[model samples]
Target: MRTILFAALSAAVSTSALAQAEDPNLWLEDIEGQRAIAQVKQWNAATEASLTTMPGFEERRARALKLLNDPNQIATPDEVMGDLVANHWVDADHKRGLWRVSPLSAYLAGKPVWRTLIDVDALGKAEGKSWVWHGANCLPPEYQRCLVSLSPGGSDADVVREFDLAAGKFVEGGFTVPESKNSVTWADRDTLLVAMAEGEGTVTRSGYARIVKEWKRGTPWSAATKVAEASESDIGISPFAVMDGDIRRVAISRNVGFYAARVSMRAPDGHWVELPIPETAIFDAVVSGQAIARLVESLGQLKPGSVVAFDIAQMLSGQKPEPALVMEPTKSQAIEEVAATDNVLWVKALDDVSGKLFALRRQPDGSWSSKAMPLLDHSTVHIAGTADKQDIAFAAVEGMLSPTTLMSVDSTGKAATIQALPAQFDASKFSVDQRFATSKDGTRVPYFLVRRKGDSRPTGALIHAYGGFRAAQTPTYLTAQPYRSGPLGLFWVEQGGAFVLANIRGGGEYGPAWHQAALREKRQNSFDDLEAVARDLIRTGVARKDGVAISGRSNGGVLVGAAMTQHPELYSAVIAGSPLLDMKRYSHLLAGASWVDEYGDPDKPGDWAFLSNYSPYQNVRPGVRYPPTFFYLSTKDDRVHPGHARKMAARLSADGNRIYFHEYMEGGHSVGADRSEDAMRAALLWAFLTKEIGSGAD
Candidate 1:
């Protein structure tokens, strides 16, 4: 996952004013440095000692672990190939998880007779590598030969090895892509379109593949043929292929930056043809000679947020561009995801914050008509899987207080609940409310409040805001897995505390315009939105000003870091996890350079002028009375450099702030490498929250 890198300083200033000397803690950037590791150990010991001294720390850890390792946890539903249902699950029994499968019949019957395809735990022990299951891509039609990816620890970079599903084993001497930030796509059973690091000079400055190569079966890595290459200014080029029935199309997306790309398709003649699509539009699917896409900017008559298609045949013939709109979402709506199912175009969208599904089918006139797929109210509806060339799709629906229910929708828009999760906790006693907080700019930002029913003035509140990356924050049981967060927050919700999820700006709540509202220099608006939500909660008496705790991971961590510094009086505690706090130096760190589009290029003096205004690391002052903050990051987090948190915590400590730091050895950009690690982290979070806010269990 890409972490958002933006934080705030109170005054407007230039990067020239905040030089490297101001951040003397830069030495901590040496992730594995002996001195840095020693300080991390010292800080971890102090934090664990203090928080563990709080009431219910041990019990909380035990309960959190129990729920995390629950034997009856829902197996996340995934479609292996259309004919079979599969899931990658991790629990106490399978620490490293299992890539297991079941027949479609058995899966739809609710008792999937799961057969393990890959025992990750066993494989890791045998290989002596903490192999994290990255993902897999199987060949089309037959879908037997697979390219399985495994990451060491939990880094974004992974190793891909070809596996034979029918034989249930790794293909001996088969196709393999060694560990790197590589992408391997099946061009055919015997050939692969690979984008990987060739050597020290082959990777982009952003630490991704700079060249696209083709690797055929039985060919040595040194003998692979180069297909395409991108400039150092670009992140990289990735190979993409689509197999729509007998029709197959292969292409590469040259990602010039984080939000921009130029796509070129390999025509039947084997020549690359550039499509005249917008640089920021997302390529969805190709069907009936039409190139389908979702636009990021208005294209002629078609507006942004419109799912449209143009004649691929016309483009190839160099004819004047003519486009057809498939779907257009309203200002309050955003297309969350899109898929093509044989004869139907599946669109799962969000209205306000509730999920609504839609299907577009071709009309006799060659145009498309859309119909709503009736879904549950106040619930999140996401496409779980779509059948191949079949007008059938699986949708998962869940709410803040509801367990997920996997629903199947056929071509006729008929829906059926195939699997419904049993409630993980007793949510019967809790109530959920969708409220709006008017920001300083007078924009109404939506947020969900989950709290105990009746006479519940929350003793404490956990307010969360992920206000960047255009990622939508939705309603679901706070289960971080199963596509999400649950019983863990139930610990606080049941204790007369409220859990608040703020749908602030710079998110997909209101589509592209909402996200664009806080881009670059305007990022302070997102912080304003979050502060408004906290103030609203206190004004409504849902939580005390001093009893409200804020938590954000990644970009959300950036939010917390800014909030704690700018409005420390609003929150009593701040939890920054896998955060990007030092805005000025972010681009100089690992993979941080790629995110210059999201957070602005600090090296450029113009971008740095605004960046210096809110950089949390530079904003830390000795005189300020800040909240006790807990900072944590993964040493293996290559995507968002751990140095962001390390340097920030070190500087804050030097400035007389009550700060605690912990760096785990594994689990890249995530809370943990395994279940127990996740549970322990949760326990520690709750411990600190309780220590600051007095448990809130009136």
Candidate 2:
């Protein structure tokens, strides 16, 4: 199964061969090899022993677990399934989480009667597998029949099983696809569109499905008809369906690169009609017969920051549809989200790092009109869910200090609070402020600073950032772990330390221009921006120069690793989780080849020249004194290989630098499989931070 998926990867390039020949720690890249597993287990034991004995470890763990398992935590709606709304719930009772549904009418009336559809913990117990819920793709109209995805060991590769909602169980011998990093879309009642690792030449070099097939019910997997096929070098290809009142179009999306895609709609004559969309633009969902797209570069009359739409009917008939302007943001703004609900389009935009929501509708004159929806000012707003046939949508709003509140918005832009979470942490004693830090190149970067009110003394600070990817860093209330924006916020701030969220370059905080400024060759700007934030904190008296710590995960892991190696004295400690460290061998790792557009191809000499400078695995000097670092990883993380953290930790330890390494057995890329594990990781992190820099409770 794995061989067919990664067969094409080994033939890639000359840079990998050279790097492998030079690196002595390549043995740790063997992921499941006996020797590598033994090393990881030993390191995990030592790290746990060292961190668990820190001051207030058990107390902090218990407190974190309590907040994480709080029964009153907000239950954010996952999807609008006909008359019922689905949600994946986690708590002390349901540790593995539960895929359940509540009546939509009752949910809107503030009295939801939930019914359990899938108890993940029970299912795992019965099957003796570490199953993680990966959501469902239910057929539209009735939403009774669905394709449920469950990932074993919480990895991205998941098994798709056809489920019967009315029967409350998996269909006996129904449509089922084996585990792989794949996609299954509902084409109709008896037919489905799937893209999975089937056989040799079917999977891309990036370990994704290169071919999309149409599979009919009661047919063998071999009998599926080919819908579309992308190049083996491209990222991958997947099929999706767009359904409005009378508009239903099934399209295949060919991901040419990490930041680019080519979309083609299937015509009634069984031919693919390609859309004239630029690769840089994102092909969003079609709503009310309009195929919407967000531009990353200027397209004809549409600006880089504009949202454009095309008539799906015109495109299907082999006619080039005139681009219709949906919404255009200012230089200070970025389009955060664009969701559709049949007749209504819900857009969430960020202005100066603060969120604002708008409800857009297609006027009778073939143009779009938008109305500003009232929400919490200076807070983060996200589209929680949108009904398939209704004109209403759900928005989750929260801030650095404010608890999260779920709001319901109607077609006319009227908003109402559906449910509000009670304060889990004492925000009254703390204050939130937005500040700007100037980078080395004089670029103004924005960040959110949270600290105790009236406390001006220098204290230990934790600065978190993800400077790669166009993902924007927004503010959220100090909530539970697993949530990216404000993970462990309460745990850190309650210790009397200031919590800082640095909105550095290489992010969509401003727009495409901001992210493009830090692309591959100019990636140093992101690290410089991070360093500037640390200096700004010290200069503003918010933190002691020697008491500042940097934390990031995944792409941010790259940031943390780069920061510590590039400027050892700037940060007191580092928390790097599930990172990509060996830039030279990154493309050869699982799913790493797909991210070449974001980080650049290490195979190319020109790309490697710039990559070699910041690549943490290559840049770490043996005698250079570095800050104490905590490196966490998951053996099941197929996206960003565990070898990254493993090799980096081994190298740092061999060099006599303080390194704490922990590799979780499950949890894929997230590092925490469930709430219990999330709480434990948070506790361990805070314990390590408290040891490195005094917990500012003095």
Candidate 3:
């Protein structure tokens, strides 16, 4: 498991060897070592005792949990199983959540009568496993059977089970795959295309399934027919099934790397045909007779980031196919989503980080034409559900000033709001604005400001960002723990505090070009972009100089850690969660090697030179006047080892820096399985920020 470490360590230079020799906190990376656990307990107890007793901790925790567990909260529409809409929900009464369905008629009545398909809590308790629902994919036409995915303890790997949706039970003697980053799709009612971790040495260097197998009804996976295999140097293969009414196609996607794929589709007479598509293209589906794709690279005359369509029949038969442009994005625009309905292909684009939708349809002369679909201004429209049999598709609309509203649309591009959630916060007192900050390289970075509606500058500001992995920070109404953009607005903005979302380089806000510019060696641009945003807010007097704080989690956590270590005087407080601080050893951690495609292989000489200089753990000095910092992580964060947070906090404290830290007992990468735990974390985060960013500097 972590074979990349051997290769990376073999290339370690004298400087890296010396850095490790001098590092005293290496013992913290032992993960489950007894001494490490003891240190974690000491830090957890110390931080919780003070943070939990804050002035508004109780109120904030109660409010966040209330919203999370409220039964009235919008039941986000997922799939169209039958004449009913399916959803997965968790509330105060149901901790593990309920996978339920509501008839379209009942749903339209504004009081959906939900019928429980499976009570996950009950299922988990009976099985004695902490089962977190990943998702389900059912057989088409008659979606009576489904392949259900459940994560144990909320890691990336998940156990898959075949279930009888109509019977509302796990299918006896049906397909059941043991957890190891499993991927299973329905090839038919009695057959499945699966790629999973099976025999010894069967996983990729990135710790994913290397083999694709075809499993038939009533046969054990061990006895299944082998279909394909991904090389040890490649990131594992995944099975893709696309349905176009009566025509169904099954393709095995061999991921050459994180960003490239070579797709081979099963042909008419049970043979495989390699579609000559750009490796960076996403095979959406066969719309009519054409195979449509959202390209990360240009295909023929189609520009990168544009949706294009090509003849599927010709390509499947190993013939050259011409590409026709579906939707081309302007420089300020970015492709958000590409989805297919029964009769049309829908492309969702972000114009200046706002939302817009377009429909691509085939003309009478065999060419394609696109029309701007009517959608509400200033809101994001997410394709929620679609069926090949029905022309109507579902989308969820949300914005900074709006709660999520489920919308239904027909083939004519007409949309209607089927369900709407009442605003959670009082929008009358707050206003939303977008501003751009020029970075050190003269790159203009966008940031969203959500604060009180007044001419006066905000007394305090909390700037948040995640400028890695090409994950864009878009404005939407959400009350979740991790992506707390909306929660920050609800919890902090309403309290007379300012919230800013920075769209820095290394993100997909502007497009792939924005992200590509900040990858690997040029990763410093992301930090520079973030610093520019903070400086702009303060210089413009929108945020108090002494009352400015920064926060992020995962990759974003590294961003906060870097900012605090590199420029401590600029920030008053820092909240770094489940971060990758020690880049020198990051590749050795769980799932860290997989990200070498995003952040270059540290074993390489060129990559190590830059990574060593940018790593936060190595940069934190004994005399650095760092801001007050709070670090948080789950004891079982298997994705990013909790050691990163542990060692950083320990080193900071050893240097006499004001450090606050908490390590939850369980919860994998997310750090909280239930809202109760999530709310407590949120309370502590807000409390720590409030404590560090005190009265206004003005």
- What is the RMSD of candidate 1? 3.9
Per-candidate Cα lDDT values, in order, are 0.79, 0.84, 0.78
User: Residue-wise lDDT of candidate 3 within 1-698, one digit each (tens)?
Assistant: 00011101111112255655787787787777799899998888888898889898899888877876766677766777657778899889888799988886666556688889889899999999898887788777677898888887766677888889889999888889887677778888989988877645777776677888899988776789888999988877888787765677888888887777788888888899888888887666677777777778766677878877778788878897778777789999988677775568877788877877777778877777777777788776777776445666677788777778887776677877777887766777888888999999898898888777874755778888889876787877635423732254467766667888888888887777888888888888998998999999988988887878888889997788888878888898988878888887787676677788888888898899988777899889878779988888887676787888988988888888988988877677777777778777778887787777853333
Query: Using lDDT as the measure, which candidate wins?
Result: 2
Identify the superior model by lDDT, candidate 1 or candidate 2. 2
lDDT of 1 at 515: 89
Evaluate model 2: give its TM-score: 0.96
Scored by lDDT, model 2 comes in at 0.84
* Cα misplacement distance, residue 424 of candidate 1 (Å): 1.5
- Alpha-carbon RMSD of each model: 3.9, 3.1, 3.8
Candidate 1 residues 359-395, lDDT tens each? 8876777689888887898798888887655567789
TM-scores for all predictions = 0.95, 0.96, 0.94
- Candidate 3, residue 134: the lDDT equals 78
Query: Lowest summed lDDT over 10 consecutive residues: which window, candidate 1?
Result: 1-10
What is the Cα-based TM-score of model 3? 0.94
Which of the numbered candidates is closest to the native, going by highest TM-score?
2
